[model samples]
Target chain A: MDIEVIKRYLPLFSKAFLLTVKIGWLGIALAFVLGILCAFTLYYKLPVLSTIVRFYVELFRNTPLLVQLFFIYYGLPSIGIRISAQLCGTLGLGLLGGSYMAESIRSGLEAVPAIQSESAKSLGMTKWQAFRYIIAPQAFNISVPGLMANVIFLLKETSVFSAISLMDLMFTAKDLIGLHYNTTESLFLLVLFYVLMLLPVSFAGSLIEKKVRFGMYGD
Target chain B: MEEILKVEHLHKSFENLTVLEDVSLTVNKGEVVVIVGPSGCGKSTFLRCINGLEDIQDGRVILDGQTINPPLQKGDNYRQRIGMVFQSYELFPHKTILGNIMLAPIKVQKRDKNEVRAEAEQLLEKVGLSSKKDNYPRQLSGGQKQRVAIVRALIMHPEILLFDEVTAALDPEMVREVLDVILELAKQQRTMLIVTHEMAFARAIADRIVFMDGGSIIEVSEPERFFTEPRTERAKRFLKTFEY
Candidate 1:
């Protein structure tokens, strides 16, 4: 609550905020790529790979992100596989978010009626062409809200990055409180930074949803 | 007359339930053959089988002297020769009406974009939908959507067009607009195999009427004789429902 303390902590908090945003977006991007690939595998029911994707989705979705981070950061080095703390935080968040994204994308793919593909095929389109032009666009429009939710969820999950020794917002806030006993100011800044990170994503998601909906059926 | 498409002994079933049993029909070039029957009689299934959309247990669909293999490949060439319009329209919701019509020609056929767009616009005009060229499917009425579906198929210039109850989903007022498009196509000597419940339209449009019951053709006769004298007892019963 002290103005002096608030000003003093701003630079540290800003640095931490940048790190959190950087790692969060990188993880979410990885998640999207993995999710899209996994969803396509599951949708096509591809041999061997689909089963592996299914197992991966279940594994990541069922477990906690904190435990995932721990395993990636602490447990891998035990087997002589060394990964930096930042990479661990990003990978852990990505792998976990990927599963949710896969489910969201899969549901979107399914929601597109069978008739759409059938119509495309009847027009002499190959399975790939039909999926690319007819199915994928509609599925992507359907998945926007769910994907945006995952984005926000994964960003909020960056709080656990502190456990892996990443210099994210939560880690900086906790470090300040332990040093200066300025818990109120630290927590306030933490909340402020998190909102600043998530609000635009939430706003952008709705905008995309509206645009997709409008594109689907004009006014 | 030269035969454009011939279906021989088509048999289709979903698991234990038989949908089309030993259905066979031949369409000559420039012929308008209409198939009519009671609900669940496999009229739609028969069209789907001919289009290679449904897997047939036993039969052959020969188009342009080539037998169509169901599992032929990812994008079989036979399907390009057989255009189909569904009962639900099935126009791509994300695309404009012009996009819907131009897609197969440009993408699958690898035709020139400007030429396909011009042909699409002409087809849309023929169907009285040129004004809706830039409109999405959801913005249009069911009848308008069906017209777009027809134009989408017509733009392909398939050797044979199959329409499965295209007017079955439209409002009473809307049905006429769609049926009129098909009638105009028939006048142009486009070979089409149609399934419909509109008896009057069928009588007017069909060169030959195929009456089906219980997954098999009960009668195939000239429309003039079929409507007035209906040879089969089932046909007699079916035509009676439309009497009132």
Candidate 2:
């Protein structure tokens, strides 16, 4: 209700929003790389590494990101393995998001019929060429909707970065509310900043989903 | 006659269940060999083994006097010399008809794009599918997709082509269109190993008929003799079923 309070805290919130976006995107990028690697490992059923990847996926996916963050930030240092809070936040988000992404990508890869790869091989394509040219593109199209969901999910997950002492959007709002008792204004700005971060991703995701559904990748 | 493919002492089994047992056959250059039998006689498995798609328990598939069954690390290069079309057409649903046709030629064979494109167009025209070139696989009928699959294989210019019941998935009406394409290839003396249940078409197109039963070749004879005076009781029984 207090416009003055909101206006006064706008600069701080803006800076925090930028921090949230930067850390969130970096974590998401890391998640994508990890997810693709893990998914391929499982898809190809690579011997020992697949078992480790399966265990990793289950461990991260089944647990809450908050606990993982706590373990990375608080517990690890107790063992003399120190990492900065910012890095801790990004790492935790990425590790958690990677599990979800791996599942999504693995499902996408599985959804492609076996005959596609067989036909590719029948054409004298190396396994790598089949994957790169035939399997990867189709799997990517199938994965878009799921991956977009993961992107938004990972972005929203950045709110918990404040728990690790990173000055993200949520931290700014909670700090302002605690100091000035402007609960309504701080909460309102928190909602607004989160939407600003997530809406474009949602829009872009749907756009991509539409293109994939319509087979835009085809010649 | 010069032999282009030779399958010697092929033994294929799936974990103790025999699928193909000690089956061997030779395909000469410009020969059309059609294998016909009751379902589950290992006809498709034999074709798959020849293309190195399935591992064999005991066998050596020689292509141009080189063993290719336990294919080398550059198996793609060996596989490139043998093209295969599947029963389900298996055209890449994400690619255009033309894209599906030109992909291996450009990517695997590393041929020029424009040249492959031109050959693909000619093949498409030959198959009566030139108009559907830019369309996706899902946009076409089963027969159209099969035609594209054939074109995909033919563009590779493999020494031998394997067709694993390519028309088996088509509607009855669509079957003839696909069969016509294969028959045309036969007229051109393309070396092909086809597995099909279409007895009349098999009789019409096959230079030699290979009759298999329970994973073993019971008969390999000329089409006229195989269809008219089948050598074995199993072949007699199989041909009897087709009698209307």
Best candidate according to DockQ: 1
lDDT by residue (A1-219, candidate 1, tens digit) is 898999999999999999999999999999999999999899889999999999999999999999999899989999999999988988998899999999999999999999999999999998889999999999998888899899989999999999988999999999999998999999999999999999998999888888886758453
Chain A alone, TM-score per model: 0.96, 0.95
DockQ, candidate 1, comes to 0.75
| TM-scores for the candidates | 0.94, 0.96
Please list the residue runs of candidate 1 whose C-alpha ends up more than 4 Å from where it truly belongs after superposition: A2-4, A47-52, A217-219, B70-74
Instruction: Using TM-score, give the best candidate's number.
Output: 2
Tell me the tens digit of each residue's lDDT in model 2 across A1-219: 989988998999999999999999999989999999999999989999999999999999999999999999999999999999889988998999999999999999998988889889889888889888888888989888889989999999898999988999999999988898999999999999999999988988888788766653433
For B121-210, candidate 1 gives per-residue lDDT tens digits of 888888898899988899899999999999999888899999999998999999999999999999999999999999999999999999
Question: Model 2, which residues run further than 4 Å from truth?
Answer: A216-219, B72-76
Residue clash pairs of candidate 1: none
* Candidate 2, residue B215: how far the Cα is off, in Å: 1.0
